[model samples]
Target: MPDTPGDAHQSLRDLVYVQLRERIIEGEYPAGRRLVERELAETMNVSRVPVREAMQRLEQEGFLTVQARRGAVVAEFGPAEAEHFFAVRESLEALAAQLAAQHATPAGLKSLERILTRTRKAAEAGRLRETVSLNADFHRAIVELSGNPLLQDMMAPLDGRLRRLFRLTSGPESTSPMCTEHEQLLAAIRSRDPQAAADLARRHVAGTRAFALSALGS
Candidate 1:
């Protein structure tokens, strides 16, 4: 059967959803910023219908919240929510690291090493945005190495939320420590030491949580 217009439209909406979601998480749309369907549709060169669908998708993803009269605003993270989010993420990432250490292929380690190198360069160059992207890539590579689709799926949402928080607080001081942690994670993976990898991952995430809380004055 030929692809219907509806299918094409859904694909377009999904694409729009991804773009808008990233912008929101990157703080381009900052907390309490309203997303107007017409404006977004015009900006993205798509129809209002697709923009609406994209907005709804982001809202469901917890990146946005629809108010009774305020329209759609970017979601805000509070101290409590931030604490819980990072705590849960720390646990999950520890498990992912342990699994990856046991299962990571040579190719996966190489990919992670490449990303780590790129991340270090980005941090040194003061390219905060690129550093954030590379940081995400490094963790994603490790998650994929775990050989658990379900665990990867579970990590996806947490990763997105964590990226948003990171972007909000990332600076020269923050990036340096993060770069060092990434190197340690890579070294652990290279040694194929599951316990060390898990310990390092946990400490890395905990450090981030503390940094984020301090920056947020929480």
Candidate 2:
């Protein structure tokens, strides 16, 4: 069967979503900047339908907020929000690592190793954005390897926010250290030590929380 109009519209919406999300994450659309459907549609040379759809998705992901008088604006991610996010992240990720240590299959382990290899290369090449992105991928891969559908469901909403925070806190100096932490966590998981994996995952979250807090403060 031929592709339907709905399929084409959905594809455009996804493209617009990725582009807008990246712009917001990269600070191109700073917090409090209003997003107009018409303006963005003109800027991207696309129809308003896809732009509107993308903005709606972004708002749902916590990247944008809809105002009463105004339409949509970039949402502010303040220090207080970071604190709350990290507190949940610490517990959630610790459990994921523990479960992964217990249940990860050989194929899952190999997938994680591949992500780590790419992460190391990105960090070594001084690619801060790519490194941060891969770091999230590593954490997410572990969560999936945990063999827990509940955890994956819980993480879905926070995934975008986590990536935003990572971009906010990561720098050239921090990328290599984050890689080291992931390496240790992966080792614990590979060893099939639930306790060790949980501990290392907790510590990793602590380090990231500390850095995020410090970055937001300064």
Candidate 3:
């Protein structure tokens, strides 16, 4: 049987979902930005069916909200929410770092160092947006290196949320601090020190939470 639109809807929907999700997480669709199906479909060069499906998924993911008159808009959270969210993220990612240290592979460490190199370049160029993305990539590499499926699943959503928060407060002052922290964290992991890696990861994430809160004037 030939493939039909119905059969492809799921695939198309997933593709559309990822694109929209990336845009939202990267701050392209900032908080309260109205997401119009027509606009998104046109922008993505696709029909509204997949766009609508993706938007619904995004709403379910806490990245969007269906309002009375606003339709779908990017979700926003309060300062307290930010604090709580990062606190949980910090805890989980610290666990990831600990596991990564225990299971650190040469290839995994090499991949992390490559990401760190790119992050440094992005930061040196003073591109906060790109830096935020690279920073996300760096931490994501670490989390994935941990090889824990549960940790991977839990940190998935927080990754997007963290990217959004990082973009908000990822200033020049934030750049060098994180670069240094990344080095320490990497060194601990490389040295096979799980406790040290966990401690560094926690402090690093805690510092980011503080930076974000201060940026929010909290």
Per lDDT, the best of the predicted structures is: 2
TM-score of candidate 2 versus the correct structure, residues matched by position: 0.92
| All candidates: TM-score | 0.93, 0.92, 0.90
lDDT of 3 by residue, 21-49 (tens): 88877678888999999999999999999
Could you tell me which residue pairs clash in candidate 1? none
User: 1-218, model 1: which lDDT tens digit per residue?
Assistant: 32998889778888998899889887788888998999998998888998998888787778889898989989887667689888788988999999999999998888988888888898999998999878878888899999999999998877788778878767788888898888888888789899999999999998988888887774
Q: Give the TM-score of candidate 3.
A: 0.90
What's the candidate order when arranged by decreasing TM-score?
Answer: 1, 2, 3
lDDT score of residue 110 within candidate 1: 85
lDDT (CA) per prediction: 0.86, 0.91, 0.87
Worst-scoring 10-residue span by lDDT in model 3:
1-10
Candidate 1 — worst ten consecutive residues by lDDT sum?
Answer: 1-10
Which residue pairs collide, candidate 2? none
Q: What is the per-residue lDDT of model 2 for residues 111-153, given as tens digits with 9 covering 90 to 100?
A: 9999999999988999888888888899899999999999999
Q: What's the number of clashes in each of the models?
A: 0, 0, 0
